[model samples]
Target: MKIFRKLRLQELLYNKKDKRLATAIKLMVGRKPLNLSLFKLAVKHSSAAEETKHGIKVSNERLEYLGDAVLGTIVAEHLFIKFPYRDEGFLTETRSRIVNRESLNQVGKKIGLEKIVESDLTEKGFFTHKSIYGDTLEALVGAVYLDRGYYFCRKFVLSRIISPHFDLDNIINTTINFKSKIIEWSQKENREVDFLLKSITGSQRFKEFTVELKIDQEFFTEGKGPTKKKAEQEAAKNACEKLKLAI
Candidate 1:
């Protein structure tokens, strides 16, 4: 009787928690979640991860990985269909603009993810880790994919997330190829520009690369990103901004 009573109490508490989470998810996603646990896990950051008896930590990292792939594929497909005459490079760059860490972070906050996310980071620490919200957005995408499958997930991404948040026209019209611009400026001025990898941190799945941009053997700026190319691009972007070359 005691064991049964304890199990009943746990179930009741779980149900209460699930009810709150379900309402939040519905307001955010415009649908009721069939599996509430997935959504719960989606909002859980690695900093607040729980360790199991088997010495395994559970968090949203795996879901973030899965969602990154899915989100990339969906965006690629959308751009491909939308820009039939555009070249491969255009499609790739446009997709990058849409799905980059900064863009996703903004979108996540706009969608009120800050209220739902479970994190142990303080307010200052939270702002310091700029990609946390973006990572959580990706994990939420993974949860949506698992809960509702590809077609529904695609619709949610397009109709709910991308369509509502992003301005495609502005994104396409903007000149964000700062790396190319900086290199062209260097060539025109007969100056040597170089990007050197400074350091890499974090685990394999979540590595952050730091790149330093140097011009004429002088340090220009530094940038960090999830990939070497992005880090280099960021460094170049900062350099261009400092030089007043970015249009």
Candidate 2:
């Protein structure tokens, strides 16, 4: 605890939002972080380090690679020892789902790492930037592994991410398209939604559509997507998110 208090850089990197995470890491690691640069790089987006040459300035990507390998090996070993009856095929798929980019991004967002990230990107970077959040999350895991070890990394992941949020029973029945679910909920409540498609512009796979949802043309929620239907879905989703406003 004293060592962690000594690391002013840790305090700087993680602000009030990461309180639980900080406490969890401190308790699980049993030792404060000594290497602050590794943690800094973990939360740093590649765009922020574009001036430095690739494979030289040390973006989190390289650390992500190492972390991915380490996580895979550790998970495989754990599953192997824990579930002696489980087959290799099942283990592989399970590990894949657990370590997928989308899953990591969800955890990263829930933990508020997005706010603490050091990135030079703009609003356009959200969807346009490929795997920034995912990469940053992986780098963070890598940093934890380096700063502490397998035990702490495993403990922190299980506690902060798996136990607190990743409920196996609930997740199985959960709706993946939350935006669409929001719209359906709104419709059931007798709320009318109107989605207006403004534009569709971009090359093939990179195309984007701008849309806005009008609740009686007063309550509006804007969204963008690759197609008109998708854009409308996003707008409806946004509208659903705003239903608590009591308008």
Candidate 3:
């Protein structure tokens, strides 16, 4: 019985290191990865980066950088073709709406990317920064580009990632001025709308802002963002939801 148990343990260990794991990851993105090492590096956060013999640190940061450019280009091309009648400003604004960090995080979550990310935040549970998922998704895109080239990466991104999750038509038609919407709703309902900049944390390069929305002198909802404007907008968005105002 002891020998049987030992064999089972060894099987588990071998399975953990199996290439099938890499193949499974590829299946998630709807494509097989030619170089699994790139995908492995893509999911590795800076906190888990290892030093190589060449005196260089390897992490997903560079991949994320490359993926950001690739994603921007793909998204720009998509927007250009989809909205040929629209002006440059409209195209740019719409593209920003689509490729924003929060949107990408949502997409990443939908694709189960969060389940595979190797990060310090994994042990922290829900307290981790939201940007990690988005960053990892971008890194995966970079890996796909390196492994499969531009055309394949673009197709995978559009078909598996963007097309399934985003409705570009709805996105184009939707207005996102949550603050103004909240204010207008408040005026109609005779409720006082107030936004308070509660606190600012972190250094200049990476500051986080907290904002709270109060309705009729009562706390409605609070939100946090990298900038005061964004924090207020988030707070207002929450307020809008709480009040059941369709945005």
Candidate 4:
């Protein structure tokens, strides 16, 4: 009797929590969630991850990885169909502009992820990372894929996320080659520019590269990414911002 009563109480508590989360999802995604636990896990940040008996931490990271692939595929297909005459390079660049960290972060905020995400970081610290919301957005995509299937997930991404937020023409027209801009500025100003590889970390499958940007042999900014070129691009973007060059 005691065990039965305890289990009943736990179920009731879970149901209550699920109810609240379901309401939030309906408002955000325009549909009621069928599997509430997936959505719950989607909002959980790595900083607030729970460890199990096997000493493995559980968070949104795995889902984020899955969602990243799915989102990329969906975006690639959409761009391909939308621009039949465009070359592969244009499709890739346009897709990057749509799915990049900064763009996703802004979209996440616009969709009210700030109120829904679960994190241990303070308000200011939470906002400082910039990637946290974007990561959560990807996790949410994974959850949607699992709960509603691929076709539904694609529709949600296109109708709810992409169509509402992005202006395709504007994104296509915008060129953001910060590395080229910085190099040109350096030449015109007669300043030496360099990108130095600082370090490489992480496992073989998931290596992260850190690069430092220097102008006239002085440290301007540092950036980290999955590849040296990406890290250098990030560093260059930061340096361009500092120099107030038109991006």
**Highest-scoring model, lDDT:** 1
**Residue range with the least summed lDDT across 10 consecutive positions in model 2:** 238-247
Q: Write candidate 4's Cα lDDT for 1-247 as tens digits.
A: 4474445443355566677787888887777666677898999998888999999998999999999999999999999999999999899989988997877877898898888888888878765655888899999999999978899999999998899999999999877777898999999999999999999999999999999999889998998999999999899988876764643
Model 1, span 8-75: residue lDDT tens: 44335556768788888989877777667799999999889999999999999999999999999999
Better of 2 and 3 by lDDT: 3
Count of steric clashes across candidates, in order: 0, 0, 0, 0
Model 4 error, position 148 (Å) = 0.6
Lowest lDDT 10-mer window, candidate 1? Answer: 4-13
Better of 1 and 3 by lDDT: 1
Assess every candidate by TM-score.
0.71, 0.55, 0.65, 0.71
- Which tens-of-lDDT digit does each residue in 1-247 have in candidate 3? 4474445443344345446646666677676555667888988888778899998989899999999899999999999998789899898878877787778877888888866777764656444565678888899989999988999999988998789989988998887989999999989989898999999999989999999999899898998999999999989888776665644
Candidates 1 and 2: which is better by lDDT? 1
lDDT of 2 at 133: 67
Error of 4 at 230 (Å): 15
Q: How far is 227's C-alpha from truth in model 2 (Å)? A: 33
Residue 217, candidate 1: alpha-carbon lDDT: 89
